[model samples]
Target: MREIRQIPSGSSLPDTQWQPPYYDAAPPPDPSQEDTWDVVRKIWRRKWLVMGITFGFIVAGAGTAMVMTPRYSAEVRVLIGLPDPNVANIEAVLRTILPNSETTQSEAYVISSREVARKVAYRLALDKSPEFNPALQPKEGWWHAVSPSRLLKELVALIAPKRNDSAAVPTADSAPMTEEQRLEEHIEAALLNRIEVTPLNRSHVLGISAESQEPVTAARIANTFADVYIEQQLMRKQRATDRANAWLQTRIGELQQTAHESDRAVEQYRRENGLYETKSDTVIAQQMGTLNADLVAAENAKADAQVRLAQATPRLNNPGDVDSLPSVLQSPLIATLRGQQAELERQAAELSSTYTSKHPKVRDIRAQIKDNTSKIKEEIERIVRGLRHEAKMADDRYTRITARMEQLKRQMGQSNDMTVKLRELEREAQANRTMLQTLMQRSKETVDQREIQTSNAEIISYATVPRNPSFPPVTLILVMATLVGAGTGILLALLLENLDRTFRTAEEVEEYTGLPSLALVPIVRGRSKAPGHVVKKPYSTFTGSLRMLNARLSLANENSAAPGGVMMFTSALPGEGKTRISSSFAQLMATEGQRVILLDLDWKRPNLHRMFNQPPGAGLADLLNGDITPEQAVYHDPASGAHVMFAGNVGRFPGYVAWIERLRMLLYTLSRHYDLIVLDTSPALLAPEVLHLARLVDRTVLVVKWASTPRRAVSSEIRNLYSVGGRIAGVVLSQVNPRRYRKYGYDDAGYLNPRHLVHTAG
Candidate 1:
């Protein structure tokens, strides 16, 4: 047979042919899923918490609605149309005068400016509102404006236009401001607030409407805007008419004076010079006419020469005509030069294909082409310069002949006619001056009429008193309140659920410690009659949970490798039901016909002696110090026939290492006779007792107190136990409160009711 080696706890198990028995319950799932579900289910089960949170939000929203202040709005419309027809179009006119949607919307924004709002504010005497009046309470008035409650309402009203139904201004003389006076400035703000000026789509008409706290004020503001704009238009038109009339008068006088002065000058000059005949300066006129004729003839000749030159020249370097240069270039030397050029061209082509124009071969080819081109250009220029000289000579000859011909003609016929011709030319000049004066007068009058026409944008319809109020959307408010309330409520519930670290259910205990929770012990409100009485068996509710714990250990028996069914109860901290749990587990096992031995392993606090009604100084400590034998230290538990061992004298006990080794050997000796051994160990965080006793036990069970242990300390305790050589049997939930558990969907009655368990104690 192969020797089986026992593996120490916390260290990796030795590789041996061993198999743990499969459990009926499913294997522990990934903790993330379990933790997440625990949190979610806790929140879902606690529906009252979420409902309470939602109600709070709903109440807040209702309060907000009641506290909000009311606002007013108004609007007025202006129509854009063609200027009075009497006016003429200006040079920059783009389209026919028609109302454009884009322009209307832009102008509406301009009308809603702060300057406009201030004007309206002043007119309406809104510097002191009923809610904002300083005389009512100056301190409170300022506070209200700055308050978040007040700010929200005003901001909403300003940005989102809505109708309002506020009472009209009082008409009595003692009223804050007269109805007319009060509404004036308010109308301005109202105009800015609820005013909507929409141009009919694809049409020239505009529709304007205003909503306000006071319906009459809305109407008045709207009508006033229309009237003011119309009046402004009229003033502009009148100014234009005045300017036109003045300009026309000035231009008429200036034109008449110019005509008279020009006529007088011409007549006077003609009479003094004795000029008459055909017209003014006939000699100079004839010379200019002859020069113009010669210029035309020269230009025609130049055109013909340019055409001949174009025909004579051929394009060099034409790809299509390689042989076009001439057969004379076929000499051996020329052929040699051409071959060299072609070779360079081939090299250049290849280089150009792969590299930039700056490459060496490309640059070399370009330089060669440039030199050949320069030589060819020089030859072409020489030929063209000769042709140009011939054309210039021909033009010079034509100019000299035309000038002489004009001089001869003037000398032959116009000698005595000079004075008469000068007089006639002066008369013609006077007539032209008079015609120019008449045209200028007419142009000035037309300009004056145009100026008058440039000044009109029509006010087509006026605003009327509004009859409806526009806000306090109840439906909208309620809907928002519902959504905010529900979401915030759920969030609050989840927060509380996550923050609570109490162990209310078996799932929670297993989730934090990575161990199965075997049983839940309910809290007892009344006393059990005797002082420090040990109810080890299921004779009372306090001891019943132990029976369930015994079943769990039995299940673990088929799984762990250790032969002895040694049990140890430990916790993260003191007062976590470790001693009580150990006592009950031993008693329950003993009642099941198994011989049980209960050891008080926690020398620092020997509590088992108190539970068994035995003096603490007569047990394990005395036996270890050679003061008594095991037979003298052991006491029989009357409740379940389980034997109990008390700590003899804590002060005289051996060190934890020596005592634990001795205890383990003792447990092995007693295991041959007893079916179960239970050790009640101290908190590992406070002392090393639990760690020492861990080696003596076959399995360990952690006791978790309800709502008492800190979650971080619990996690650390689990990690500590795993670090040592110990096997975990399961967890036990002690002192559970039924009412509190019910909120998390845990049914306390299902676990506590007596009818569920079948007993065979008979």
Candidate 2:
């Protein structure tokens, strides 16, 4: 058994003028109270809904995959070979300059080109083939009825202009295309869409693939595309070679004429100018060379003569200095005179030593020396004159040579101009001749190579018929559909959950109502055998919740200044189990040895009498109308051990406004006898009497049905009660499903275990 604390009596009543904390509006939800686990719990609760939607999508995807037609694909591999060596070298040079990847990509683009598709379509006649043309095939099922393509085609046909023979018609020749052009576009589109071209990694190999409903058609299209590509390559090479040959032939002729004209012009110019070619050893060249040598030699001779004149003229001024001159020394007359002078000087020296200064022998020797010296001086003068004469003759000879050389240089200058003109003409003719020979050789080579030109690509492997389809992989489709559907379903579930305005947990009630949840009453599935089931099943969860609620109400009553006061039970809407909660709370309080009274204050539709199995006779309505006394109206139930005042015959009573004073008197009278007064009032939203009763009561507890009543409705009713100065103690969440509450981890796992239940002796 659980212990119950005795609430103190003689407490003063709470102020009737008290207003609700959230009188204007409902309180905002606290963000800290809402955690990630709350969201996870919400999603977990709707897991089945999400899983069902995902499975449905997966099934639909599988069905779609099964309905789709299987398409077969065939491939052909071809090598984009290097340019031919025998043909024009320009193609080979271009290939070398381009990167390998670029060339391979170019080849792939050509393979998938619309032009190539047209060629294949023309060869295969695919426009008329039923396999390729969708319109030509027979309609199989209603699947075509919903096709967007078919619908668009039908709409186009309806709006299209009709052709009439009587209408003014344009001439057929004015159009560039023939009647076949109408079907050509359709065939090209179909072929292009069916073909796939890809290049191998870093290699000049292209893979051309074609897809179709029929394997044989796919294989044939692939192979035919390969053949067409090869033929196109060969044709392009041949055309290039032909163009090269034609251009070379035409250019060679022009070059030949140019060379001939140039040669003729050179010869004519040479003949008219009277210019002749000359070697380095020619006569004029040799003359110029000789002139240069002679000029150098004459200048050398002049310099020598000048030097000799300078030496010889200085010596002629002194007779004694004549002995130093080689010319005078070599002369025989001068040498004989020199010897006589020396011998005379020697005889005079000996005589002067033996006799007086005036002696006759000394005098005769001195006279002889003077005569020899005069003769030597005369010979030296003669030699000096001969040297001057020789120098003059050499100078005159050099001057004559210089005059002749200057005359030869003037003649050589005239000859050199003619030689330059001859050399220019010769070079022009030689160049023309060489160019003509080269052009002639290139022309011959181009002509010979034109017939043997080859393509730069070749087919390596032909396509074979494919055994399997490439599209509509059922497993992959199902997997992807499942993933997408699961994501969408989870998102939708979360959105719906957020849109729901109901309260699911105690935290929500507290956060939104701005009041503590006094109790969380687990849902009782069926009606009990008696209204006093709380006392009968004392250890049950319902009874336990009721006991807890009784304790909270007692505490509220203790807190108020007035003890033994009324605690009204009401909800935002009807059918929220407020009556049951009130009855159970009264019974639990009575079992705890308290004087409790359960009042059926719902005048419009009262149910307290039904719960107690009593007749609707002489209850609150009779007492309020002064037809009965308080003792006569109050009936005690033995099972619940509490007094019940039923709302008897409300149709016979006066209106609620007229009976307000009497109702207040009746409540005050009951408060005097009972320790706790529980009022089961009508829903606040449905009855105005609930507000009146709430104003008269000491404490008002709003009963909120869990996961069923909207928070807006509860808050609105709460705001109404508060508007009229009603004292709301707190809220109580009724009818909480225990299993769901446990799933949310709200209930302590071992707290309510069977071991905790005390078994009384029978």
Q: Which one is best on lDDT?
A: 2
lDDT values of the candidates? 0.61, 0.74
Name the runs in model 2 displaced over 4 angstroms: 1-39, 75-97, 140-143, 147-179, 199-209, 278-432, 443-464, 473-476, 526-540, 554-565, 588-595, 610-618, 628-639, 655-658, 742-762
Query: Per-residue CA lDDT of candidate 2, range 87-195, in tens?
Result: 5543331222133777788878787777778889889878778866766889767866755444644675689643232112446666665546646765776677678
**What's the TM-score of every candidate structure?**
0.55, 0.72
In candidate 1, position 23 carries an lDDT of 21
lDDT (C-alpha) at residue 176 in model 1:
83
In candidate 2, list every pair of residues with a backbone clash.
Answer: 11-561, 11-562, 12-561, 12-562, 13-561, 13-562
In model 2, the worst 10-residue window by lDDT is 1-10
CA-only RMSD, every prediction = 29.7, 10.8
Cα lDDT, model 2, residue 165:
25
Worst 10 residues of 1 by lDDT: 1-10
